[model samples]
Target: MDKSLILNRLKNIKNFATDTELANFLNISRSTLSNWYARNSIDYDLLFSKCENNVDINWLLTGNGYNVKNESNVLAEPIESSRKTKDPIYELQRVPVFNLEATMGLVPLVDGNGVDEEKVIDYISIPSMPSCDGAIYASGDSMYPLLKSGDMIAYKRIAVERAQIFFGEMYIVAVKLDDFSTMKTVKFVHQSELGDEYIRLVSHNQHHTPKDVKLSQIAAIGLVRASIRLHN
Candidate 1:
């Protein structure tokens, strides 16, 4: 759908002074709306439902035909109800995409009070996608074949106390090195032959061998939920 037209019409209907007000009316964050504008697509059904019976579906979606200001023939509700019977709208989960440059990276995202409002670059909404806490850009090809550089990795935080190590699974892991500096990487975590005190980080790339790190040095861990690669 053409979000440009839809966004313009929304501003006209609501008499909104800014896009932030429109996002608030839709019960979504400004980042979500900005993402929609950037993607050039939107959930018109979600918009229609939230607009109540004020807007005409045709006008709201395509920006044509009779609208609220045109006449009293607002058919938004009827069309909405009809579509609900045929195809119900599912609420898509919106994941905050945080910029690694903003903080120490994924570690800080899952470490403390969660998402830093200042660090959030944007929000992404995916249909039928798994629940995710936050997302960061994959930098290296350590997990190549399974992941590549610049891929968006959606992850859910693992509590420090209840950190369940699902061995042999992909995770965004952060560890403290011998120099007390933090190292963040995406790899398949395995049980270290060294024993319960450490874990093995494996790479899918054959040339890269698995390495072990002390479990005590682990600072943060997040289970990888989904991966998205945007096309130009």
Candidate 2:
């Protein structure tokens, strides 16, 4: 927010030691530079035109981008930072683990659809985990060894209405059956050879066979992001 600091950063990027040098580079008089410094006001037009590719307008205008020390790119930061900082940007997040069964009571909260946030019974803050909306305990042995019953799985909610997926990824799904029963379980959702109206649910265990059900049958869906297995 300090225009003077921004102007100083520009000076550092240009390797200009003094206000007179920067003023000459900006095609402005030293007095004009002093005037801007007095008011802490900078003419951004001169920077964009004069500096062009050398100035990283993002870092120049707002101190939001990476802090770079390299002279080659100057203000511009590479995709990857060679220098290491404290990584203050990364922080631990408390993901809500709901009481809902991984199979039955699983509700889509990624979009939070109609579900209330208060449904969260507990929070699990694990470092270096993917971002997710909530977590649920797997209800059945359908997924077996990979994701046994009672394993707490963090899930990212997704709109199951006209669901889009990268076939074969594990997901928690709520499906309405022909018997008017609702089934919620975690399984790999694969494109149904049965056609567009249906999706095949594949269980990890060999004993359980893949079943193709209508996409319309899926009432709610959540992409399984990470799982926590605890044994007593």
Q: lDDT: which candidate is best?
A: 1
Point out the worst 10-residue segment of candidate 2 by lDDT.
69-78
Tens-place lDDT digits, model 1, residues 18-41:
577678988999999989988997
Give TM per candidate. 0.55, 0.55
Give candidate 1 misplaced runs (Cα > 4 Å).
1-90, 101-114, 160-163, 178-180
Provide the global lDDT of candidate 1 against the true structure. 0.66
Please give, for residues 123-142, the per-residue lDDT of candidate 2 as tens digits: 78775554455688887788
- Cα shift from native, residue 101, model 1 (Å): 4.3
Candidate 2 C-alpha RMSD relative to the actual structure: 18.0
Clash tally, candidates in order? 0, 2
